[model samples]
Target: MNDEASELKPSPKIDPRLLELLVCPLTKAQLEYDAVAQELISRTAGLAYAIINGVPIMLPDEARDINAVTVAQP
Candidate 1:
């Protein structure tokens, strides 16, 4: 495959151990991995943290509010 085509491929799955260790920074609750969306869902916190290039972006400011409600500032 060409470089461009290769670049379009999905990122490798995140380490299971790392996922087990991760928690929602806001709620300190367990996270659910959504591989299809490349996000870590925090149902308690109503947020979805994006996983970029196999790395989870845990920053609340960078997270997307899955519930459509405002994420309070820290």
Candidate 2:
């Protein structure tokens, strides 16, 4: 049986080799792996692509705008 805490712990789903090979689909630029956030940050594209279930969602539409700012409504 696996330890409950260990099982619950979150781990990076992406592979190191794959990370090196993967790039921003839009800009063809290098991507920075964010293990904590489970995303690939593309500075050139100014986007953060979400990695779900060990799969990187490289689609632009699904990516979050890293440069976008959200203002709180008072």
Specify the highest-TM-score model's number.
2
lDDT by residue (1-74, candidate 2, tens digit) is 67997779786579889989999999999999999899999999999999988899999999999999999999
- For residues 3-43, write the lDDT of model 1, one tens digit per residue: 99997887779899999999999999999999989999999
lDDT of 1: 0.94
TM of each candidate vs. truth: 0.82, 0.83
lDDT of 2: 0.93
Stretches > 4 Å off in candidate 1 = 1-4, 69-74
Residue-pair clash count for candidate 2? 0
**Candidate 1: deviation at residue 42, Å?**
0.3
